[model samples]
Structure formats: C-alpha cells, structure tokens
Target: AKLRGENGCPWDRKQTAQTLVKYIRNETEELIAAIENKDKENICEELGDVLYLICMITAINEEQGNFTFPQVVQGINEKLIRRHPHVFAGTRYKDEEELARQWEAIKAEEKREHRQAAEKREP
Candidate 1:
C-alpha cells in the first residue's frame, strides 16, 4: 500500500502494466549479456535484477487488486505438477523421447482447456 500511495516514488506510482515492457526487455538483455560473458558472478547479479522487476510488476498488479503474488506462484506450481506426468503423476517413461511425448501431451491438454474456458467468456 505504501509503495503505491501518493507518498511513494512518482515513477513507480505512475507505472502501469504496459509500461514495464521496456524494463523487462532491458533486464532480459542484461541477463543475456551476463550469460554470454560466461561471468558466473554477473549472471547471478543480473538474474536478481530481472527477478526484482518481476516482483515489482507483480506488486503493481496487486495494488490494482488484480492478482497477488501467492496466487500467481500457486497457479504456476500447480501447472508444473500438472505438466510433469512422469515426475508426479505416476506415469511411466522409457526414455527422453517418451518424456518429451508426455510433456507435449500435458501441454496440449492444458491449452485445450484454456481455449475452451476462454471461448465461454463473454469478452
């Protein structure tokens, strides 16, 4: 609340979800540069910067009462569990080829479900 309050930094308060694109792109480039340099230290530092931007953006959404960080994390964690059949769903895999097949199958199912849900929406 304080961060988004009037007393907060004007730059931060004025930021919208759409405005973060350049920031995300810049952080992504920085991370890529660190990786290309083969500098483990810079890689770690730049990764933190990228993650910080993500968190900040999440906070922006939360201030608007759109979604919270825990909700986003939970959704992704559940999706990971849903997607990895061989790891958690007691599905058998023979090799990397079979693993890839399972992953794609799970992904396609998720996509179909999402599409169906979207189709049902008014918008």
Candidate 2:
C-alpha cells in the first residue's frame, strides 16, 4: 500500500498491470535460468522477484476495485484442490495419461460451470 501511496516511489505509483507484463516475463525467464543452472540462491531471489511482481499487479487491480490479493490466493488454492482430486479427494488415476485426461476433463467442467454462472448473472 505504501508503495502506491501519495508519498511512495514515483515509479511504483506509475505502474499499471499492463506495464508490468514485461517485468513478469523477464523475472520468469531468470527464474527458469536459475533452476536450470541449479543455483539455489538465484532461484530463491528470482522467485521473490516473480512473487513481488504478482503482488504488485494484484495491488494495482485491488486499487481499481477489480480484485484483491486474498481473492487471488483463495482462487489458486481452490483450483489446486479441485484439480488434484487424486490427492485431496481419494480419486484414483491409473497412470500419467489417465491423470492428464482427468485434469483436462476437470478443467472443461469448471469452464462449463463458469459459463453457466456468467449466463445466469447476465440480464
């Protein structure tokens, strides 16, 4: 909050979600490089950078009344749990191919549900 406040850094204050896309890409690339090279320290640093960019983008949207950081966190948590029924819900998959198919099917069902909900919301 302070970073985007009236008294905060001008660069930070001026950033928008769109403007941060390049930084996100660069940070992700750096993170991939760190992982490939097995540089644990750089990997951690790059992870932090990527996480910071995500929070910054979330904060920007939050200020615009679009969504909050907690909503994003909750969304991913729900998605992970929903997608991994084998681990969380005692569902069984025989092999990698079966798991991949199940994952896609779950995603398709979620998309269908979302579309239905959106249709219901529309006038």
Q: In terms of lDDT, which candidate is strongest?
A: 2
Worst lDDT run of 10 residues, candidate 1, spans: 1-10
List residue ranges in candidate 1 displaced over 4 A: none
Candidate 1 local distance difference test against the native: 0.87
Q: What is the model-wide C-alpha lDDT for candidate 2?
A: 0.97
Model 1 per-residue lDDT tens digits across residues 1-123? 466687988888888879989989998998999999998999999999888778888998898898999999999999999888677878888899988887898899889999999999947
In model 2, what lDDT does residue 17 have?
A: 93
TM-score of each: 0.89, 0.90
User: Candidate 2 on 1-123: residue-level lDDT in tens?
Assistant: 899999999999999999999999999999999999999999999999999999999999999999999899999999999999999999998999999999999999999999999999999
**Which pairs clash in model 1?**
none
Clashes of 2: 0
What is the C-alpha local distance difference test score of each model?
A: 0.87, 0.97
